[model samples]
Target: MNSTTVSPVAEVGMLSARERSDHTAFVDGGFLYVWGGHHSVAGEEVFFPSDEIWVYDMSSGVWTIYAMGGEIPPTLSQTCGCCVNGVLYIFGGCAENGHTNQLYCVDLLDGMFTWRNVTDSTGTPPSPRDKHSCWVYADRLIYFGGYGCKQMREVTDSRRFITDEMSWVTIGTMLFRFWGWNNEVHVFDPRTNTWSEPQMHGIPPKPRAAHSSATLGRMGYVCGGVEAPSMNIHCLDLETWTWTEIVPTSTVPVERSWHTLTPLSDSTLFLFGGLSMSGETLSDGWIFDVHRKEWRELQHSHRDKPRLWHSACLGQDSDVIVFGGSRDYALLADTISVLQSPSQSHCSDLLLFDTQPLPLLRLCEDCIGRNARTLEQQLSWLPKKIQEKLRKRILFFRTAKSQGTYNSR
Candidate 1:
């Protein structure tokens, strides 16, 4: 996976720049759906209306906002979300009032684009929390460690992780003593609308929040967020409900949080910019080979663009799509001024990273797409499946042209 990076993040001409951070994005049918989170501008933290969603057509390279219909949750930042099939499900986050345990779902392709509050499902829900990561496998949502309130009734399982576990607690005394972190795992099944916590056996990692995660087959990988400068990775086996730590055989990434992890294949994942353990924002990129258990760095352009708390997802073309995050932490209200370097923290730039170059193939495809209609008479000599494939690409290319967002970025 190590190669001299060529093209940097793909830039869009028609898309206006708007700095955003702590947002969430997912891919569905060649389009990227972004929502939630907040951004700071002009030294002030800005929050978007929770009901509005930004849709980016990867095929067309166009951006559109959809004001969703039906119930919308009030929370903004640090919410756990994931898209399974055509449905998007969200659970818990910090809102204007405070932390909440609200479950919201929406169907992106259904004629009715609406969100439904499903918090009152059949089983018990987790406590109000933020900064957790969710993984979807076998049509179920798997949730793990994050910051949240402690439950009184069932101190039976996660009693070891308490709010006072943090030695650096100096502010928010009440929050430090009452609210804390947990390493609990919860499963939500949409088929029957029930929540279940499987009995786990193996030794689990330390309770953490603000970590990154990715789903590969039956295994879910979690990294960092141990409140220390360490590159620790833990893997969860979905079939057995077990956890095992992974020790990379080679060089590891710098300890970071608030970064992104996108799976390139069943055994490959791309890790990007994050806040370092020293409180500095990072711009290095790494590719992890799961089978070999090794980390390889990507020498790419645009390393000058450092971002944290940003959102990234795998695109339809097997490219990595990164969007909306702070370039600096100066505009943050909660972050200490000494921790951040002076720079433009709020960024609205959307970048595409192509790991593998196919310039010749792409050129040919473009030529064919542009003149697909003219060559329709020649399709009689080709197989039906190949003809259908050509037609689909032509339709996609034309859609992008019609949207006026077709650019060679």
Candidate 2:
């Protein structure tokens, strides 16, 4: 597939040198937000960055760093999050001290954004966990499997535990330990402000963490993880509350963890990048057709951009914005990241993967964005996401100064 990228015509404000893993990224309004990922050495000694959030304005290509308000959650990563009704909600990740189940959110619509700790929520949140998948369905937030804070009833007998190697690796004098991964399901209903664990029937996927998921219609699909069933795909039917394993007729991807599964539409999903079970960071891309039950690989120009624990968010006009991930995968590594060290493959690059059939459409949109003032009436009906994307295109275009510097179609 042909893909192109757009860079900020120029950076603004205080730009952070971020090299992180297992962080969270979500889209809201006309902007994409990235927050709370950690950079650690040898997977134990963690380094926390500023209490801020990174915002990418789709219209202007201006990358701005904003100070977090309200009660900010500690610099966190390996957590999961999603945006709903302009609010970004984050749950369960490894903090500086340990794992936490604390639920926090920030309203992106609020000009002076503040992190609000949602304390009024009732019932039990899942145990503190990291690397889980968060899904927004039926106006509810659903979280599935991750390296937990403690073993739960849903934890199966098979699966590898991160702490299993505790005896070999040492951060200093302290020995690092964490709970194993489980296939537990937790749901939070914002209307009632309550949390509930559903009694799922049928055979559940093996307990695993660092997996990837995307929800379509009433079915929630999960693929790849650590240890068992790493390459298998399974979907939970939200209507019937049953799990059915999907047997792909074509090629099956390498077993991986920390990969990203992005829904391009309700029936199609995109898969890319992760650490394979054999200890390699994967860089290949695949597209899964939900109805056909087949996997097709994506051939792109950016093969060298291998990343794990990174994020890929589908943007307006079929664009996939990938950013902020480390390249050093245990294995099965794929995707892209910025920043490079002798040992660190972590990057802070904000890449735009334009996956459009006609590349010139992007240029036409840019033209419209540049002439938005004169053409306001013609573009008024566009969705907020598309409008922002069009407006933001000029942020780089103006800086390109007729050079088209960042255009790589």
Candidate 3:
């Protein structure tokens, strides 16, 4: 077995390194969490600090580390991330010494790394950039405008990562360019592996990085990030490809960057701590309901100092786990936290309600919904009998649901 260590704080509620390690890009298939900044061990400087990826596991409630491949790159702030088919991809950021156009991919299932030469690509990847906005769709990884290295100005370069072809393609350029800003959203079509130019039809507040975007159903929402004086929430419709400016009705989070946004089952997005304009980091949290278009301040609090550039992930049972980053202006080595999902009075209200209660002779709707594709992919993982059983069950659910009798149960 790989060398694994447990945390000293064995409290059932707290997270451990084992759990956090699962958040690293390309860990646990295609699951992704935020990556907090790196710090050193006791009395020792952090090795390859800039190249290290820190992840938090909601299951174990701990922080874990994974070393980046090749020589460690310089320390970078405000990089961008996305996941495609279980691979974690990171793109352009400003290192301590300079800006970078490097693109790296890590496989979560096997813990392997592959670095791509973006500069050498025939399509010409974006110039060395920092503080960009990025996302993944289908199999394409798309990155938008960011601050350029030489000009030190925001640019409109659009680059893509195509997994099947294992190549980088520069799509059409952005309509506008601005850096040190937030509120830009881009979507890619994996089928075509190309990007649509920045949609100007919507009332997108303004272009900004350090903001967060989460997709619920077909709609995506962007919320709070540094925009100078204060932060605000905004929504985008993936279907219409338009923006809806939202005036957060409840106590909202402070404006900041390098924070996290995670999607919950009920179409709610959680916002965690980030760096404030005054250079102060935050530990406070908030939740935004996309369906209702509202925000609610979280009452619970943590003992750890406020931090920025930390990572967060949703785990089984609706628990949210946070991992390492800087606290009180210094990098942190070992810190982890887990926040349980708010209690629900009805079992049917649990996120798993639709997926549970494995069918006996019949197939459970939940099983078919969640595991059907996974089972098909790993047919060899199960015995022939089990595979047959699952197939039978799926057929039953499809027939029942189609007949409209499944809901009667």
Candidate 4:
């Protein structure tokens, strides 16, 4: 079978030049908001929680940076977040010192921009965690499994016991460790100023973190995460309070973590990119039909560029806007790709060269067919004498090729 070169469906705005990964992003009104991640500079990890907010105007496809005000949250990455009514809420994430339980809110309005800590409590909040999944429903934040702090007794404690009491009176001290995974379903109601872990019906999902979640109507769906690299799909019916395992009829992707799932409509979802179990960063895309419970993998130009721990959101024109992530442990920034739905048949308007390697001969042949005139126009930038000689050689080569007398290189 002959393979064909396919360009991106569309190209829009790009992120800033700072290489970053593990950031959070969401769509609010007519803008796309992105912030808070870390980048490596000469083997040093630098976080960007206090960096100016990056905003992309959906209508114009332009990016702008806005300075944040009020008390800014500490530099954080691998955080969980959700958007409700133009307000972006970010929950616990790991900072320079350790994981944090702080909640930060930022308003994305035109004339009313503010950043404030909104963690007031009439009830208990979830413990400090990172790599969690969060969704917005009924004016509340619904948080799912995440990696967080946990306490365990020292190993020696298990060996000591008293025969009479069947327990040791004095045992090894409790030790705190990070990176415990849980399947607790925590809900935070902004109106009630409280957090509650409700009793969910049916079997809960396996304890995993760095999975992806999305809400559609009365149900919420989650898929794939760490600790277990199996392609497991689970759903929670908010109205009925039940968990149901969804067995897909088509191809289910391999086990991966730190990917993103964005709802395109009430019954359709766009899934893309993650770190796979074999230590590879994936760049493939897939579409999940919620009603049919099916998965269809996408083959497009963006498939060659792996993006783990990136952000994706639905754009104004129903295009999926993808932003920063990491590839091969190297942070990626400074570019954004828009995936046009199949309904949009027009080819891409911009051509971008990425770090991913491609077949050079095929790329040149494609350019000769689609952009020969553009290349000819650019030749004017060369010196007049060189340009004239090159133009003559090109004319002679074209004439010879048309007459079937040109020799193969």
Candidate 5:
């Protein structure tokens, strides 16, 4: 297929960055507010408590502690979350004491909380699950398979809740059980409040967990999650329900999990730090071009300390807000960074060259027939070396940028 090339634009501006420390939290409010789990002061592993909610704002880069008084649900982990309007919905997480099948919603605009017992409803909710995947479409929240008691058994059933009716209902089941991996893509229709069965073209990759997925326009991209052997990246076209594997052409980023993926306006996806397999945290960033299926490793001079299980979201203007994770195996509460694309003046000129022989040049038979000899004349001034270099660069960059930093050679 013919592909279009995009020149790297100069970095012209920066967005605000913030540092709020907590562990294994999620970001909401369009990247403005980050809510995270609490940790003990002794720097030891402690179960998160549901009584307090840590909140961080990107504009001021400040962390605010909120007391969730009343009958708060128990603290939990591997919980799936989604934001609809200004409210945050959390579902199906393993609590400190045991697994939980409850559903809770936190209002960002009003600062109120509501918990519902899913068992009391008529529609059958998916089995008690943890580490599941969920997303919001229109007014409905769609949930997919998660680990049951066996842990990573792949729950195939699906369920959703319509905000207008304040009710829960079961959607169709996914064709494949996704319990083993968290990177599976689940799309929902808000108008009907139902999930379309997982659809994609070609043989799908194996299931994985701790990967990152996000929507860009009508397409969804999944990147950098671990399976048995290594991390892999994939994309799904929502319109056609098709899947394509992305092979990077540059030095890819390190393999990681629990990272954040945010969509930018320029048809690119931005990825931030996460935990490497060796349990070390990372602070590097990368970008993937969705249209061209390419990847680009970013150079950050003012990068923050490495972290894992943190939350990130796009903020006002071009800003990105990140919050909460662990460092050195200890839960953290003090390091936060607001990252923005560097100013265009800071970007150095990049001379891209291709380094491959051109394919046998071909023209439309009718066009060649109209001016058969002229085609050769048009190609005379094009240097084969330069042409080859440009082709190689384009192919290399596209492959490297799409797969992220880990798989690049």
Candidate 6:
């Protein structure tokens, strides 16, 4: 975690000349790295793909633009990226002429930052495609559905359903109506440079493109994407190679695509903006507790811009940083916003309280109770329902007690 004190109050800042959309970002070494998105000029209908790399400092709140060494990757959009160890792996995306199958990486370890185009001579690589999903589990990289040449789709134009009441059709058979979807599962082991198409068990997710995948424990969870935006969630057990459908206990997210399903430290996936099937950009955000199988919409109001094709990266101290995406009329936003969690706000309160004067600390000692050696220990005494509330309120006022010392200056 970054040691610098970050305020609990949420902040939104616009980056100059950093406006883009359809980009990919990941956190490595407490810093956020962004790469390969497209930006549109005012009064222009076309989006120019970017090959530049942008780094955001979590502690100092600064952005660094780096001219990467080695063979620079082609300008692309809708790519997938994940951090393995200290290396950032960038996979296939839509290029200028078309989609690509190239895999590139930038080494951040040993302070020798350089790009390397890894050769895949061991086995056949997956088809060249974009709008797919990739996740790093242990030492393997799992790749899933995308717009590609593979004949993984279930149905053709010949299949038709007369009514919604047709219960005889299996899900795999019925989902074939939506073309350009892939149910194939591909795994790449970086250690041996091998690719394996695992014969997965149980019912696989309906083929769809542009979905999000993340690792939780030994399971890989996938959620909502284009062609099927009904908030259907599925998890693949990495151990058993089986798929289990997870139904949320709340109202499902609207049918949408291009949104982010980011895993947070609190065992919840923070879902952000995307585009609905009606071509309407959505600004709503929700948090889904994977363990409890519940969804709760974030009610604290901030800047609400309906966006699609944006990238979201979870930052230090429970801050979900959102950057670059398209709004209505293809207007590209250059803004960066941090969605602050309550735990983060509480964290700030704890920071402020810890720096108070001795007399002030003594005054609040009684209210804090005994044997409360640490914040966690103190919080342990409170009931589950109101523990967080009491923790925040107590910590906030502890700093308020020391305000007069600075105010006098």
TM-score list, all predictions:
0.81, 0.79, 0.58, 0.71, 0.59, 0.69
Expressed as tens digits, the lDDT of each residue in 350-380 for candidate 6 is: 0111111336543454355222345546577
For residues 1-409, what per-residue lDDT tens digits would candidate 4 score against the true structure? 0002222122323323245677777777766676776666556556765736766554334455566678788888678877877778889987877778788887665434468898566677877777888878888899987766543432122111111111122222423432356777888887777888787899767777778888888789898886645665688988677999888888888888778887777887878888787757787788888779898886567665677777778764455767666665422221011122222111111112222244664345434433446588777687997565455445533443343321221
Instruction: Kindly report which residue stretches of model 4 are placed more than 4 angstroms away from their true locations once superposed.
Output: 1-17, 49-51, 110-112, 152-179, 330-409
Point out where model 5 deviates above 4 Å. Answer: 1-31, 61-63, 69-71, 117-124, 139-202, 228-231, 330-409
Quote the positional error of residue 255 for candidate 2 in Å: 1.6
Model 3 error, position 57 (Å): 6.7
lDDT score for candidate 4 against the true structure = 0.64
Tens-place lDDT digits, model 5, residues 1-409: 0001211122111211122233334455422343445443343334455555545332222334444544466767667776777666667776756556676665555544434333333343444555555544346565543443322244332222111111111112432322223333454443343434554466454554456767666555666654421344566666665767777765677787667777666487778877676656677777777666567776654254555556666654444445445443422221011121121011111111111122333123223333434554554366997444334334333333342211110
Worst-scoring 10-residue span by lDDT in model 3: 344-353
- Winner on TM-score between 1 and 4 is 1
Pull out the clashing pairs in model 1. Answer: 10-352, 18-348, 19-347, 327-345, 328-345
Query: Candidates sorted by TM-score, descending order?
Result: 1, 2, 4, 6, 5, 3
Clashes of 1: 5
Of the two candidates 2 and 4, the one with more favorable lDDT, higher being better, is: 2
Model 6 TM-score? 0.69
Clashing pairs in 4: none
lDDT of 4 at 103: 84
Q: How far is candidate 1 from the true structure (C-alpha RMSD, Å)?
A: 7.4
Q: Which scores higher on TM-score, 3 or 5?
A: 5
Model 5 misses residue 67 by how many Å?
Answer: 3.8
1 against 3, candidate with superior lDDT: 1
